[model samples]
Target: MKVLVLGSGGREHALCWKLAQSPLIEKVFCAPGNAGIAEDAECIPISVNDFEALADFAQKEDIAFTIVGPEDPLAKGIVDFFEDRGLKIFGPSAKAAQIEGSKVFAKKIMAKYGIPTASFEIFDDPQKAIEYVEKKGAPIVVKADGLAAGKGVIVCDTVEEAKEAINKIMVEKAFGEAGNRVVIEECLFGEEASFMILTDGKTLFVLPSSQDHKPLLDGDKGPNTGGMGAYSPAPVVTPELEEKIMKTIMEPLIKGLAQEGIPYKGVLYAGLMIVDGEPYVLEFNCRFGDPECQPLMMRIKSDLAEIIMAALEGKLAEKKLELREEAAVCVVMASKGYPGKYEKGKVIKGLEEVGRMPGVKVFHAGTAKKDGEFVTNGGRVLGVTALGKDIPEAIDKAYEAVEKISWEGVHFRRDIGRKAIKHLPPKVLIFAGSKSDLPIIFKTEEVFQEFLVPYRIVVASSYRNPDKVRSLVKNAEEKGIKVLVAGAGLAAHLAGAIASETILPVIGLPLATGTLGGIDALLSTAQMPPGVPVATVTINGSINAAILAIQMLALSDERLQKRLLKYKKQLAEN
Candidate 1:
């Protein structure tokens, strides 16, 4: 089928590339496509903002499917326009697009739908915004109500700064007509993540969580740009937590939009701040996010054409969109002094060399072919992405590629997975309670690498084999173990044995199998003898056991400390 893509950015290019590969697609066309996209699909000259021209082109070309790539067209009701003329389009209607088009509208809908989000107030005047800032105190967030290309929001550290921001947005017209209204929101401190879902206005197909680097500089410093880099399958969003996000954020938003008579279709992007195991909506984007989409598309195992068609045909609920288990990372190469003033027209080199690396893909963002050579055309240039079996491998591959490709003044974060590395080594000292706990403990060890932690798994029957447990516990101290996590079931004595043997912290994980469904083990683990402190997690809590060990290790290691802080911040944001 003929597919028409509406946009001119890197996201649209990637969509066109993916769609062109589908056997079901006979032809792929992109409106005003870039140099990179022109290699894959036919580029049309019609501007994406020209709704009338786009509709006319789709009809004339007999395009069977139209995919809106940018939010501007969706906000202008391009999908609705196409549908009116009996053309199939994959994107939300203008009414549904308000979730991203207007911050005030999104916040209001979130509040009405019982969606968890930071408390916020909308303002059209400068004085009211300043008043809200003064009332809310410093370190709050100020956002322009309409789109400003992801540079519209500011995190003000003081009330004065907030006031100045309000003046700039509402009075000075820093963002032009887009800043006619503003949203003042409570500052939520936590780990921020991007979650996207493909919906047919009813059923939702969730994608892997991704973390985007919004700040222009490393370590999250400097002004926000249009996503300098991104990585997918973020460890921050645990499987359990993803369920909470789907139930709390995605489901409610979809149902809420449908209830309002706008059967939302296409990608619904949620910028979430996870706090204390809860995810709050930081913002919403109607279309796929830039760098985030690059890595997500790389990791998705399902066919893009089929997914979009399913959503447009109102059959998304019956379909299951599969994603690869591998992780993906993308690092952005920017022009000098991005998010402000930056030099352009610099020739980029080593692209072919970097792209040759296994699992590496160089997706051009702000680039153009001038005089027979690729040159930088925008602030953010190329997105160097790679997929791996795990996050570290992905990081290693991505950075390797980043080193090869170069333009003037390209920068990236060095600590992308620095936090995740701590969990790579499991610090648990599993003390097998009798010979019975051996099999289960070994099984737990087999899956230890899945949690990305190193393990010093041991087999020692604490009750019938007290001598072995004592020797193992003594050796554990010499090996510099900060915490002892013992996995034991019924009449669990492994925890007590280890706790009594060493002054280090001990954690007990109860296994479920016997008469009480492991409650007996739980009580045994929890109720340690006086002066012998043992932190007891739930039954089959080996995962928590490893997590606790990592937390304990973070107390002394600065790298681990930062990771723990990030994890805590992510938890708080959710």
Candidate 2:
């Protein structure tokens, strides 16, 4: 029926836009909405943080359901206030909101529940924070214990920098009361993934994983903003990894909150770190993320109003949330010198043209109507999103839309999916006899890394499991791996086993691990049946195995040839 959204940012605007599309929603209203949000829903004049005023307005208007969009109101007990008055609100109580409002509180809960996260120490006294920084060297993370608009965390590379950050946050009050306490945490290196779930304090419904660009500038070389851009279905968060994250991170936090009498509801946003197949919790957000939400809403197949209602009514277990199999990408357009000083109110152009592009939609983040014209009113202006059957297609469509929209000094990363391309079905699989032959395979690894070729390396004992070798070759053929590299030491049957199973090209690497110094292995690998062929490389030569694979992949990819040539040039200089 009637839905009331509380917030005044791009995220709130996107929520309002999605909610308006639901057939279940009869009417929608947004409190102090932006120019873009005004396009779909009625905009009220009450401030988002004004609890009493918002409650009064909701009651007077007989709003059927209210959804809190921002974290501040939730932390201020706005949801509890509404619930106490018998109003239907979708958000967690103030106690549950602490999972995001206070970093120390979250860390303590995670620690108590044995959740995997970076080890950290909390300090309320400025002197104590400085002492911790002095004891722990650089390359650590310093974060404000409370919310600081996503700019409170600093990755310090030196002890001096960490000390300076601590002093600024704790002593100088750079972030005001939000920085009265600080958290110094160990630095964990890995790819970051965002895992969000809809919950009703008991049952959890997971959403697709998204990778967000936190830094303001390209190449990840600038200060953090409220996510410059985000893309969904990130390859790093495979189905296997998502399950692990839910078990290790999300489940514990949800159960922990309930045990503490918070009984959390609505979205639980978990920032995660995937390190070598293991997932660790990085941070928590009380509500949906801004740029991340823009693309996610584009991909979700379920009704927005129904999902919120289910979570609020404790019927999330009975509800089924679905998402499209396609990939979604969102590129944020921001004002020049964003996350810093920048001018606003500049007229924007080509929004309609961009949104009209195939599979593209524009969600306004910061804009206001002046004289019937859209003008920028905040640092991040809009989230241009596109969906496609796959990431490559989505990237192309997203950029197509991006090219149409224009604003002075707007910027985004051109290589958002560069890392993801590696997971694309590998063109080759290289198998070695033993770990001793790793040196030979190292060269192949280097080649694949240099050329950005998708490939995998496996160590197999040919003699120990001849049948397993046959199975491996059979599976490779079934999966369409184009080439194979077989390396062995003595009595090298690796090539023969591969050749006997498949008609695909096989390169043999002879390692000098035997008493005969690889002569037997070399001879055996070089000789093959009349119909079967196995290409042979020099003794202990893994580089040639890589070269052979590259040549096979290059037969179909002309662009890869140019990349290989550049890699060769860089190698020569080194």
Candidate 3:
């Protein structure tokens, strides 16, 4: 099957790269792609705005389906245009795309559904917007009603700045017609996180959580550009926080859209503000974020074609995306005077050497081949992405690659993913082969609760959802889940599978089930390939699993070690 991706940025390049790797895909093509994308897929010069021309090309080329990378075409009803022409496409309908196209529309949906977001008022008159800002006082947010390529919203610290922002957006038309109206909101203060998910209008599959650095200068001290850099999975958006975002933000938004007669599909990217563990929506993007997508694509282990097909065919509930356990970082290299006046067509160097580095990629957002040499073609030039054991390592690896490649006026952020390095605390995860194993799991949970150890429980079938299990296990270490406990009956290979995914210690609790008197489970749980090991407990020995997990954790935790000794003394006395 041939697939067409729209847009000309790092996001499109990453999409093209991943989609081309699908066995089912005969060819992947990108319309108006950059120099980097040309290496991954055939690049077409058709403008994304020319929907008619694109539809004709897709039909003539026998394109199986199309994936949109940017919000422009989606906002212009490209999905509807293709579907109307009886051609397959992936993206939200124009009405649904309004969530990203118009801030007013998104705010209305949030307000109507009681989805948590900032309180705000809308205004078409420039003076009215300024008046609202003055009344709201400082520390307010002013946003253009329409799309501004990730630069429409301004977080104003003072009333003067707020008024000036209103004037710039509404009076000077800094963002074109998008500034005809403005949204003045009470600023929601917190760390920013980017959460994206794929949906079939009913089923939602989460992509990894990532954080984007938007400001132009280092330490977030400049005007916003498309994006400076990004990393995933964002430590701030913990698993618990991801769940909350799904329940309180993603679910309601999808449900609310359905209620309003819009079946939202494709990617729903929530630009979030997480405050005191609560997630609040700052804005929504109907497409994958550029820098964020680059790193996420590096970590994806699943076939992109399959996931997109599942979403399009309404079979997404049965499919899950698997990503590598390692963390990913993308550092955007821009022209010297980016988010402002900048010259292009300058020669870029060192790309070949950077490409030779393992676990690294340089995705071109703006470049062209001039006499077999790469030259800058746009404001944001390349996205240097790398995979590492954790965020810090990934950050370093990405920057190392960045250092190799340079142009006359290359620019980038120095502190990408800096905020998360100090916050990730190791956690313990318990995996049960099935929900039926909950009885065994409860025993483990009891010990953890008593000892005040932080842990999470997951139920996945190593037989049925093998990819999910592998993904969970592989990602455990980076997600701060340092210890794993697998409980299963029968052949009991779940623990072994978890053990194989990572070097993290795995404790196996064999269940007492079946006709073999639980002996089968005990043996299989104990057995593993050469050098791979599982700390097996006796049949139905869940208490032992919990104690072992805590013991492993206590190796580095002095307080926990003391607590475990006290618990051991009490058990001995009893």
Cα RMSD to native, each candidate?
A: 11.6, 5.9, 15.0
Per-residue lDDT of candidate 3, residues 165-238 (tens digit): 98899888988999998988888878999999999998999999999999998878989889999999998988
Of 1 and 2, the candidate ahead on lDDT is: 2
What is the lDDT of every predicted structure here?
0.81, 0.84, 0.90
lDDT of model 2, residue 200: 84
Tell me how far the alpha carbon of residue 150 in candidate 3 is from the true structure, in angstroms, after superposition. 1.2
Candidate 1 on 1-574: residue-level lDDT in tens?
7999987777777788778878899999999877777878898989989888988998999998998888888998888898899999988889989999999889989999999999888999899888878877988999999989899999998999899899988999999888999989989988888898888877788877888889877678888889878888877788898999999988988888788877788899999887876898999999899989888888877888988888877888777778888888888888887788888888888987876688887777778888988988888788888898877668767887888877667766665544444334445566666467666666555334433345666767676778877887887766756677788888887788788889889888888868999999999889987899889987887667766777786676554555557667887999
Candidate 1 or 3, higher lDDT?
3
Q: How does residue 401 of candidate 1 score in lDDT?
A: 81
Candidate 2 vs candidate 3: the TM-score winner is: 2
State which candidate, 1 or 2, has the greater TM-score.
Answer: 2
Residue lDDT tens for model 2, 91-194? 88899999999999999999999999999999999788888878888799999998888889998989998988998898989889999888899988888878
Task: State the displacement of the C-alpha of residue 212, model 3, in Å, after optimal TM-score superposition.
Answer: 0.7
Top-scoring candidate (lDDT): 3
lDDT at residue 8 of model 3 (Cα atoms):
94
